[model samples]
Target: MNSFFARRYVITGIFITLAFVLLARLFYIQIIDDRYMLFAKNNVVRTQIQYPARGVILDRNGKLLVDNQPVYDVMVTPKAVKPFDTVEFCKLLDIDKPTFDKYFDKAEKYSPSQRSIFQGQLDSTINAKLGERIAEFPGFELVLRSVRSYPDSIAGQFLGYIGQANDATIAKSNGYYHPGDYVGISGVEKSYETELRGQRGVQNILVDSRGREKGRFANGMYDTAAVAGERLKSSLDSRIQKLGEQLMRNKVGSIVAIEPSTGEILCFVSSPTYNPNLMVGREHGNNYMDLLRSPNNPLLVRPIQARYPPGSSFKPLSALIALQEGVITPQTTYNCPGYYVAGNRRVPCFHNERHGTVNLASAVAESCNGYFDMVFERLINRTGPKNTDTSFTSWRTNVAKFGLGAKLDLDLPGETGGLLPKASLYDKWYGRGGWRSSTVISLGIGQGELEATPLQLANIEATIANHGFFYKPHLIKAIGEKQVVKAEFTQKNYVGIEPQYFEPVIDGMQAVVDRGTAVGSRIPGIVMCGKTGTAQIRHQDNSVFVAFAPRDNPKIAIAVVVEGGGQGARWAAPIASFIVEKYLRDSITRRPSGIEPGYFMNASVLPQPAKPKPAPVKAKPDSTAKPAQAALTAGKHKKKKQPVVYAAAILKGDDDE
Candidate 1:
């Protein structure tokens, strides 16, 4: 009996002590631990993403190039989503049940503390369906987003394209980006991505038991106000771009036109171009895949990326370098027997037909291979292992002045550093191996290893156009009043080829348009000085023409190349002429006869001329028109009339574009 009583007393003591401790803990929870209470309430609260608008892109003339449109995405948090109408839900969203489940599983991969979207950029029909059925499905929600669109799609390549950020992009962007964000991929858009992306905003909302938002947490102070991206004023001319694209149909090469004084690229075209619209929104992946696999390589930016032999286009630099070094004079003479015989071998000229006697100016006018061959050999022999070579260094210096084998700073994405040989490079290449001067003589006729980008070639023409100086080509005009987005010119390659040298070269080039090989491209009143080049590039022949018109005060400098072109004058020269005429004169009348409109190749520019001539009202199909047709017709410009505009120009995919 005594033992039983002792046990009862111990049990009561233990029970009373435990009850008191429980009471104390309850009081602590009610009064001391505010953290748990706050956390419990936060269980239902959420922060939402607020997407800031992307920047608009405009041309120098203030035309809109890129814009954004509203879009939506439907997503489900697996834990939050409840079951009902599984088949109907899948069908409504145009997805299979398995896909829905797959996305739900993917969403669970993220931490439970933060919310993330599953599907993105829902179509309008699905968005409408989601809106009507969203209230019925508890955890299902729609994320509001935006899609990029190009209204005109004119500068597809120049403006580039933007798409959702991938793993690589997210990794590189740091805090500035998330997986679903868009990024610029090429051209000006990629160059100014940060300025165009803008700052994103976030909103946190407080909700009750039924998932209705009650009010802001701490007066919404943690929220961010979305900031818009800055607009860019570009240096693109829409009309000029259109005309150039029209002329480049069925062509494989590039055309780069620059404003000589400003270096603003008027039109930079790579043939077989694609529509810019093909790269935006849901259709991008498909189009991108197709473009990549196509043998044509639509993605290649030929003007800046392709490095090809400058061919005869380089002879001008050689001639100028020789003149600058006093290796030759404008009055220098060379004897030709149709080929240059050095040592024991003869390097053949264009024909068995001999250009019997030639001077520096006449040599250039005639593109006499014999004259350049002698000059090259003389310069080489004067510079080397045998002779005192103060003039040899001058030879390389003068060529460098013409920007050979160097990259010119430009706004475009890819600019190739074209190849020009150096003594050291030759030493490293062939110096130790007994590579002799004979091995490099072909460079004299612009045929050896020297290469240049179309962009650099255009700049070279501008150099001649300006009589010595040239500016670096650029694309963007400005960002706003705060920034003048100009490209700076570097003098690293400036040859210091004096105006005295340029004067004679200009005369030879002028003769090219007036009476020589390029006579078919003659614009009657325009004193266009140009050089035509035919280079054997891989399996195809590349015809290139570089020119600057109104030779005295050049307004435009253009470089054009046509792959598989048989001769420099046939296709390349005419193309260069048309571009110049379109940009400067604003019309062309010289056809097959050099007397009539023939058939207007670029038909859309003018309607039809009243006198059965080229311009169209029934406007004259004047290729080079004044800024205004009336202004041109009112002036000294005349037109030949009445012709079929699209006779042979049955270009595909062009008319619709």
Candidate 2:
């Protein structure tokens, strides 16, 4: 009896302990951990995203370049959808039944209970028309969103465009963005995406069985308010930008103009550009495909992406390097016999004018090939260890001080550092000590593997304009009300050249506009310093020019490249002159006569006029026309007729080499 009692007591103790542990777990789950309870409640709760308004972009003078317009996205919850009139719904949404079915399947695949976009980016008129009857449909809801709208359609490449985020973008967004979120794709928009894309908010609400909102969940305790994006004040001058586009209408090149003192880009123009509006709306994919298929390659941002040999425009920088190295002085002279001869090789000058005993200033003014060649040879030979790698390394280092062969780290995307040949490359090619100044003399003329983008060339001119220092070039002058210019852009970047060395080069450049090769492009009242370059290409020469205006206190520095445009004086110089005149004088005094507004095949390669399109016929208004239809018709009529524009193509293609 005693043993049986002991065994029974042990069994009772085990049962009691198990019961107590179960009760404790229940208490803990009920009081301490409410996650399961919340999950159960979430079945009836709905969460909606509140997208904030993107910032407006304004030009320097507060002209609205880019703004936002209210757009609507049709959202659907597949589970809430009931058997309804499919044909009627398709007719109301202006979509075919197949599209409706396809979208429904897609939404169901995403999530049957959660809301997904059915059709996005509906315009105001369409959204209004659909909103009146949308309540009759059980599963569909209209969510308001903002899309980019351009007040003035200019600076398509520089301003960039926004589109829906790709899978990669969403994966990297750290839960900030979902599949359908929009993101900036290029240019200023891409650079300042974080500042321009405001913080998102969320709204939680209680919903009934049919997906109807009952009230804010928990009296809106978990709701977060959306914050609007910060405004951007760009450095671009809209008028100047427009003028540049007009001037480059028929060309295949780029123009980069910077304010010399501030390093603010006034205008960035890439030819063969499209309307920024084309990149907006639901049809962006198709329009982008068309642009991509075009032969002109309008998508390429030529200012910083396309590398061209600096050509004669490089002479001023070469002169500065020579002066800084003590290999040449303002009084140094060399003779030009219409050609530069080194051993068996000869480089010919296009000019017939004999520049005999030309000094540094005269050499620049006349663009004396022999003088620069001699200066380069002296620079290489005068180094401590003569005719050695040290000589070439010293020469390259001085050149790099001018911002050559290195990225300038501008805010824009896809900026090329350009090519700067190293001494090692030469040593590898011709073996060390076997090659000397004579073998690399072509570099003196800016022809042998010395390439630079228009932005770098413009910065070089800006450095010269500032008398040996420059601020890094930038696009955004201010962000929000703080005027947040980057410290890098504010600090002066010196070229390691003495300030005194620039005067002779500046004087020669001034003479270039006054009485030299670019004399025809000279402005009447403004004192301009300029250099003309004709970079050799396979089909034809690439015309290039770099200039700074009002020689005393320069306001603007500009670089222009015109592919296959013959001499720099012919196309690039005049284009730069026009840009300068417009900026300083606020009006263009001269327009090049050869250019006219018309359509043409390969406008950049060759000049030709195209027949204009016929005007639209005016239609008589009908009395039964709806208000929306009438408004749309009026809008069509009110579209300011754009002037005839030009299209470009690559001339018989040649390698950039």
Candidate 3:
């Protein structure tokens, strides 16, 4: 009897201990561990993401360039969905029943209990029309969002466009972005994405069965407010940008104009551009595909992407380099015998004109081929052929100081460094000991492997205009309402060349617009300085020009390229001149007779359907020609008789090569 009572007592003691441990665990789970509580809360609470408004982009003058318009995304938690009028819902959303079914199935497959986008990017009109009736459909909610809207349909390439986040972008966002979020694809939108895309928030709302919202969950204790993106104040001048687009209409090229003192891009125009608005809204994908498929390659950001041999426009920089190396001086003179002949190779000058005994300034003003060729030869061989690579590297290094052969780190996307041929490139082509200065003599006149984008060329002119120093070329002047200029852009970058060396080059550029090749493009009172170049291509040469205005305390520096536009003086020079006049004076007072509004605006250089050749007529010799025709005929060698306004088969195909 004693043994039985002892066994009973031991069993009772063990049971009490077990009960105490179980009670302790229950208390810990109910009070200390929030994970289970949160999991339970998820059933009664709906967490809605609050997407903030993307920042507005404005011109330097405070004109709105980019704005936002409210849109909605119809979200659904499929498990809570009940039988509703599918036909009525489909009709209200303007979607066919099959399409609605497809979307519903996709969302249901993605998640049954969690919400996912059913239909996205519905405009405010649809939001207003559908919001009132959304209560009829269980598990459906209209979540507010914003889409980019371009007020002025300009700067399509510069402003870039936005699209839904891809897998790569979402992964990069570190869980911040989901499948339905929008992200910048290119241009300023891309470069400033972090600043332009604001902080996303979340709100927990109490919901009953069927996923109908009752009110804020627990008095909105778990809610976080969304922060709007910081505003971007772009350096672009809208009026000038619009004018540049008009001037570049139907042409295949780019124009980049910058303020010399600040390095602010005034106008960035890439021709054959589409309306930025086309990159927004429901038609975005189709419109983007069309632009992508266009033969003109309108999507190309030509200012920073299109690399071309700068041709004669490179003479000024060459002159500066030669002067800096003490191989040439202001008084240095070289006679051009029509061609730069080094053994069997000959680089011909413009029209192969013989410029007799020209100084550094005159050589640049005349775009003298032999003069710069000899200068480059002396520059390369000054240290001797044994050190050819060293000298070439020195030259390359100097060019880089002026923002060549390297990215400018501009406030936009896809800026190519342009090609600055390294000694290794030549060393690979010809055995190290097998070549001398003569082997790469073509680089003297900015041909062969030397390539620069319109932006780099414009920046080179800006560097020269600033007298041997330049601020990094940029598109955004400030950020946010405080208008904070980036410290990187404010720092001055000085080219190794002394300021004194730039004087002769500047004088020659002044003469180029005043009495030299670009004389016809001279602005009357603006004291513009410029250089004209014809970069050789397979089918038709590309016309190129670079310029800066007012000579002293320069405000604007510009570069223009016109593919198949013939001579630089005829097309590119005048285009640059018109842009300068518009920027400085704010009015184009000196429109050339047939070139300004009619020719530049209407002319198309892209290939068109061939028309029957006009029947040849007997040649008549008459001295009389219109000012426009005379301008073409007055040059040393007459241009081929292509129509002034339009031509067929002009693009006969050459890529930027």
Candidate 4:
């Protein structure tokens, strides 16, 4: 009986030990760690994201240039969706059965862990359909997004375009952004991308087993609110932009207008420009590809990129340089017999007329190549080894003050450095600075390799207009959060030209409008001062005009270029004058009725030589011969671009809202 009791006690002890071990193991698994619970939670709970609204762009007058329009994107979680009607969903979305099947298969293949858009560019039609069918489709919801829209139909080139972020961009800015993000590719949008692209927020939601979205995770504790992008108020004026566009409709170059005192760009236009709104959203891909393939490439901002020789207009800068260096005085006279002869090359002045002996002012007004050549030659001497040690170095310093040979560092993008070959540059080419005026005489009249963009040319005129100082060229007047727009640009550059030199040049420029090649652009009742330039290019000529209004206390400074459009006075003058009149005096005074000026609209000024020619008769049924009466009777011409729609309807006024 004693042995049996001992064995029974030992068995009880063993049972107690096993029970304690089992309880300890249960506590370790259930209370000591949370790995399994996290895994379990993840399996049942669903998380989603909602994109925030992007900021808007407005003109200086508080008119909308770009705004966000509500759009929807259809996203699907393959695992979360259940009992989805296949046929009705496909028909209502207007997608084929295969497309629907493909998305479904892709989502399933990627699994519920993947976040991707299944359908994009949902219109109001699709939004309506999805609203009604919301009860039928589970786990598929419309993700609200915004598409960029342009309310105004002007200044498209200056505003630029936007597109999805690429691989390289993602790698660089990945900390702040993600895949499928939109970015400004050009213009002000590109230059101010950081201020324009707002911060993104995220949220993690808890869902029931049935995939119904429950209230926020931890009572809105785990959500990050989005920061909307800043509002940008540009320097562009809607009225000026529209008028400039209309004035440049038949041209093929660019026009840049700025307030002389502030360097604030009022109108920036590149001819053959396209609608910027066409370059956003689902339609962007196709439209962009087409524009890229187009011959004109209307997207390129030519005002800052298209470089051309300054022609006779550059003479004014050269004259000022010479005068400041004391190489020539305002009373200096030169004989002009239509051309300047440099041994073998002959640079011809306009009209082949003889001005006999002329002073500096009349020389500029007449655009005499001979007078400018003498001045440029003298300027080279001042910059070379002399008692004063006048060298190309000092000349370059003076030219730089005029805003040449470098980027303007404007708020706008795509600004190019107008080429100004220095003495060192020539020294590198001519073997150690021994080359003389004979080496680069044409530079006197702004010829040779010297090239400048229209914007730079305009800035030069602005400097001339201001006597010495010019406001830095800028496009954005204000930029910051939507609540408060900050002034982002405030600076000035002063050219070192003496005030005494400015008066003579101003007189010469005014003489140009009074009686010169640019006389046609002279605005009545306005003291207009301007310079006309006709640069020689391969196969044709490019017309250029630069001006600042109301000679004293000027307001608007303008630069105009017409490519393959011969004679500055013929093509560029009228456009510049119209812009000046519209800005200073309210509206244009001269309306050329029954007389349409020759513009870049034509492939050729005339299909044949500008001679009286006979008309052709209608072709009869002739099988063996292709004949125009066996004579060249081609005098007919056709315009390249036509006004298919009315101006008011096509270029609607700004901010309809």
Ranking by TM-score: 3, 2, 4, 1
Q: Which pairs clash in the backbone of model 3?
A: none
Model 4 lDDT tens row, 1-657: 999999999999999999999999888878987787777767655555556666677777888888888878777777667886788888878889999988777666756755556776678988888878876887677777776788876788888877766667878885555444567788877888888878777777787776667867787677788887888888877877887777677557889998898888878899778888788756778998888896656877888887888887787888888888899999999887766665344545554567789898888777777888788767667545331124656666887788788888877677888898777666665455445564566667776667988888999899889887888888887777434433434566767778789888889889887666665556668988988887654344577888898898999899998786566666676778877887776676753221122232332321112344446544322211112211111111221232322122211110000
What TM-scores do the predictions have? Answer: 0.80, 0.87, 0.91, 0.80
User: What TM-score, to 2 decimals, does candidate 4 have?
Assistant: 0.80
Best candidate per TM-score, number? 3
The sequence of per-residue lDDT tens digits that candidate 1 reaches over residues 493-572 is 34487787899888888876666667667786788998877664433456778889888789999998877554566566
| Clashing residue pairs found in predicted model 2 | none
| Backbone clash count, each prediction separately | 38, 0, 0, 2
RMSD from true fold, candidate 1: 12.7
Lowest-lDDT window of 10 residues in candidate 3? 648-657
Compose the digit string of candidate 3's lDDT tens values, residues 64-178.
9999998788998898888999998998888999999899998888778778888888866777889999989988888888989999999999999998888799888798877
Local lDDT at 79 for model 3: 89
Model 2 steric clash total:
0
TM-score of 2: 0.87
Poorly placed runs, candidate 1 (over 4 Å): 1-45, 75-79, 84-86, 97-107, 110-113, 136-140, 209-211, 215-219, 385-398, 422-433, 481-483, 487-494, 591-657
Candidate with the greatest lDDT versus the true structure: 3
Q: Which scores better on lDDT, 2 or 3? A: 3
